[model samples]
Target: MTACGLPRSGPTRGQIYSGSVEKGGSTHVVNVDDRVNRAANYSPAYGFGSDFQSAGQVGADEVRPGDVLGLSIWENVDDGLLTSMGASSTQLQQLQVDSQGYIFVPYAGKIMAAGNSPDELRRLITEKLSTQTPDPQVMVTRVAGDGATVSVLGKVHAQGVYPIERPTRKLSSMLSRAGGVSIEPEIAVITVKRGGNSGKVWLRDLYSNSRNDIALRPGDIILVEEDQRSFTALGALGGQTKVPLGNEQVNAIEAVAMVGGLQTSLADPKGVFVMREEPQSVARAVLGRNDIYGTQRMAYVLDLTKPDGMFLARDFVIRDSDTVYVTEAPMVQWTKTLNVILAPVNQIRTTEQGF
Candidate 1:
């Protein structure tokens, strides 16, 4: 029977949990070092090096729908066969790129213009006209830009949609163009959404490491958000206020110090536990490792009583949504027992005095 209520007696739930765990119905217990090593090996799906989208993969000034271009074609003689074909006449006139990403040119019919830059279009047009006329000159000019735009919103000093006027301008440059993040930049979390998928990058990390400064694509939504990552502290510890994970990573020892260490007189220092559900990345990384707990949830315990336990705690890192629980000391439980037994005696004495 389990520790909860059951007819047959077997391994209690407590024994199963803290002692020999059942295969199907047990939470796995892992040492602090094993847990830390697994976490260290885990790489995030969306963060600094996420291969979501690359910048400058295409030209910034590349042609797109809703753009106007000036196309000109000429033969050796000023008013020759090219002039009669409507090529010379269309040079002075601007042609709008259609919604279907194409433009009509004399003799050439419809040309795919949305993916090619002005210079690229010019060279292509010249090659097409070479068969009809000798050394035909071609000119392509972009009159307007209606395709390259990005939106910057949330927690920024100024939130608005800005156009990426140049190919070299990227994600970081766009944030600067929007007047950058709010007064508290350190705690800002920037989210980039592109093509239905999104990823987050800490502003502090972006500022410190250039590698995190990825390129921006047109129609990309850049949102500056507050750092909402946090952890909870419970039992024999300070108030259960939610502690923010902040912009930078924090180790477990630092987390304990920040929340005020365990209640010295009442907490079992040796029974400190960090309870967490395994993240998919971490689970995948440690799945085949025999030394690691393969369960979905894990309770990483630290015995502060041992000198080396403090060292392990120092190296252990606290993750978001985790709970740092410090169990009560045995003496504290004994005190609670005495208080319950003394309550009746105190009440009886008070009633007698009242008579």
Candidate 2:
């Protein structure tokens, strides 16, 4: 049996292989006829059989223009009366909603049609027609522009404007329409800004059991940020390196691991050092320029090699462009000097190869 609890079948002989039964019944050899019957009766619940319904309702009141309206007229004109009265039928061309949000009708001068439903516009036209003809019959329909468009930019697939047809369109709907996030599981970051206030929404949070509510308006902008995960593994490390940031938050331990762990082969792991760039304002007085220093200042730096440094690392959030550098041991300076001396030879060899 496979993981889904379906019996496995082989190509050579279409029969169920004999296996021990948990109920202690004697195993019977399955015949090809029984196999065909079982195969024919098999039904899967989670595959193509599952139908998808739209997440929200769409109504005509949600219609806007550049919208096309199809208008039809029905009148109680007697056939003989029409023949005697010389009644006529007229067909209009592609009627568009004008800039002022009004549609021009044959008899009705101008009717505001942009935000009104077809039934509502029909009633309005009926009222206008009542002035000239008693009990005039008319019909109005919305043929286009049921869909409203919004734009998504700053790091998303199909990062442009898209049209949404439903009024209950959510933020996730727009993201899906825009081809989801530009990056994958570990590097994706989505930021939703609404009413001048910003909030972060992770892809995992979106798909979690605890759903996050992100409503969308017509002009709302969603930004999917690129992976900014970076660490400068320096001093006392096995290999001084820079690690690329992935989607999830990277801590001091993970950052250190990227540089091949603490150089236990040379330096003391307990004496590791992390050098973070403190905000310029915190060291403003250190710059010895009083005229440039201001009170509205922000600064941050956390050392993670000390015993209590893990707590600081947990509390300290890395900023977008912040750099994290680890210090190497003093004994490593000899290796650095050797590399510095060989740098000229390496460059000369590279130049010779290019030539």
Among all windows of 10 consecutive residues in model 2, the one with the lowest summed lDDT is 43-52
> Candidates' lDDT values, in order?
0.71, 0.51
Q: Candidate 1, overall lDDT?
A: 0.71
Candidate 2 lDDT by residue in tens digits, 306-348: 6765654443333333344433334444555666678899999
Q: What's model 2's lDDT at 181?
A: 78
Candidate 2 off by > 4 Å:
1-60, 76-93, 151-162, 175-186, 191-200, 209-213, 219-229, 239-241, 265-317, 331-355
Best by TM-score: 1
- For each of the candidates, the C-alpha root-mean-square deviation to the true structure, in angstroms, is 5.8, 24.2
Q: What's the TM-score of every candidate structure?
A: 0.76, 0.57
| Model 1 regions lying over 4 Å from their true place | 1-20, 33-46, 50-58, 70-94, 106-108, 119-141, 279-295, 350-355
lDDT, candidate 1, at 352: 98
Judge candidate 2 against the unseen true structure and give its global Cα lDDT, from 0 to 1: 0.51
